[model samples]
Target chain A: MRKLSRSSGDVGKKITETIEAVSEAIEDTLVVSRKFARQDEETLGNAERIIDSVLRRFSRAASGLTESEELLRTENNAINYEISDVFVALQFQDRVSQILALVCDDLNKLEQHLNELKSQQADEGSSRSVNVEQWLEELSKTYTMEEQLTAHDGTKAEIKTDQPGITFF
Target chain B: MAKTILFVEDSASVRQVMNSTLTREGYDVILACDGQDALTRLDGSKIYLIISDVNMPNMDGLTFVKSAKQMPAYKSTPIIMLTTETQEVKMNEGKAADVKAWIVKPFQPAQLLAADSQLIQA
Candidate 1:
């Protein structure tokens, strides 16, 4: 029982990491939403996709984490809720960093793409609708650029970037 | 071959450390996170010893031991209760369940190994 009790602690830590990943994904989505609003529509669209991707990852991660936590509860037979919390916090840092990096990378790309499009067409547009149209065009251009990014490397970037952008308030 | 030991614990970090430690000590360690699950795992395995914790959710350690002792297979298997608290009443309750030993928590791995050998040998 002593040895098994110790093993249950390990399962609890894995559940902790899983929960942290879910939380990180949620935070990242918020960041993506905010960042998309400040940029042109093209940038916003890309940001939206990134947000969606993060949301999906969060869902999957949350489910896996929940199941694992349940598994731990089922296996340990004993309740030591207080000690479990400390271990979860300790394990969360790693998962948080990984989710944050993915979010950060997607957000950064959207910002860069939007900046490039704005610089190219900034002076040519006067009406907000024209700017909107320009943003849409830039979004298409970014799609191509993103594709090129994937083509250059064999790695498949599964981050989704297809949602409508929130306009800056 | 070292005797097979089954450990049922709820905490994750503790489980990893024990799995590694017990596995290294030449004992085949099977882990269950809860008492109900432990009972399931016990079905076909040759478990010579049982190490479990008290105050767990789903099924507490004392309850688990009492149920296991009723099983013909585990009736005589040496059982140890691990706990952070050394309450006399709890120890007596465990004795009623046929537990062979009680080790206070914050146990050294070496001490546990020694206890296992001594109790199993006896």
Candidate 2:
């Protein structure tokens, strides 16, 4: 029998650090994403409001301007439409933030599961999987995300949430 | 009276988007954060449809759909899974739960609206 080197590092500390790191990352993401998202939303909303006000104010002022000056109105209208398009495009961030939030949730669950695995590892050499197979089955029944299934697919861990397809069950 | 749809999703932005869109389309929307919350929202209200995210905190979509189907009113009320998953195992699990439709996420509002209309009309 080949004897592997006995590792002296504290496994408990490593697991604790990993979980803490994940929690910290999640908190940081939540704080930063929310802050930036709020700023982005305000910027977009103000742009729309400014556009609306400019359009209303300019259309009235345009009545008194020369034909050449009225060309600026057309250009302003185009600019406002472009600004609106940018606002719509920024909505993609909402979708991305939603996905990132879900990732944090998974990290939280992973920490819990890791803690459970560590506890089982310390209790003799009994296989936790063997003892908890039934529990695992029921545990999956409580799944709440498509990512959970994608993670277990054993193929490419591709998370294609943007694709639109429907199947009847 | 407008038709009521129960939407179970954990994200506030997603819920807001869906609620606004559906409300604009003349439907009343009730919301829940997850499957367990969805069960509580049931509250014997007349719901025309149930749309849910597959992965959620507290309870998952598959189990919720299965549990909801156990009820008489919900058995006939169609359910659509709005998720990012395309795995056969997940599809099978949803099928077992009696989910009527599986619409992958990042979907167009029209796509789901069309499905909702078709199912409701049927």
Scored by lDDT, the top model is 2
lDDT of 1 by residue, A98-158 (tens): 3455456656866877776677677766422235555544543433123334433457644
Give the runs in model 2 whose Cα sits over 4 Å from its true position.
A1-164
Best by DockQ: 2
Model 1 over residues B1-122: C-alpha lDDT tens digits? 77899988776666676677678778889998889888888786568889887756799888888888888889998988766433466778888788888865445555567777777787
Candidate 1 clash figure, as a count: 33
Model 2 per-residue lDDT tens digits across residues A1-169: 1233233245667888999999999999999999999999999999999999999989877775766667888897776566434433433444456556756775687678778877888886665543456545554564544555455434555555456478876
Model 1, C-alpha of B116: deviation from truth (Å): 1.0
lDDT of 2: 0.76
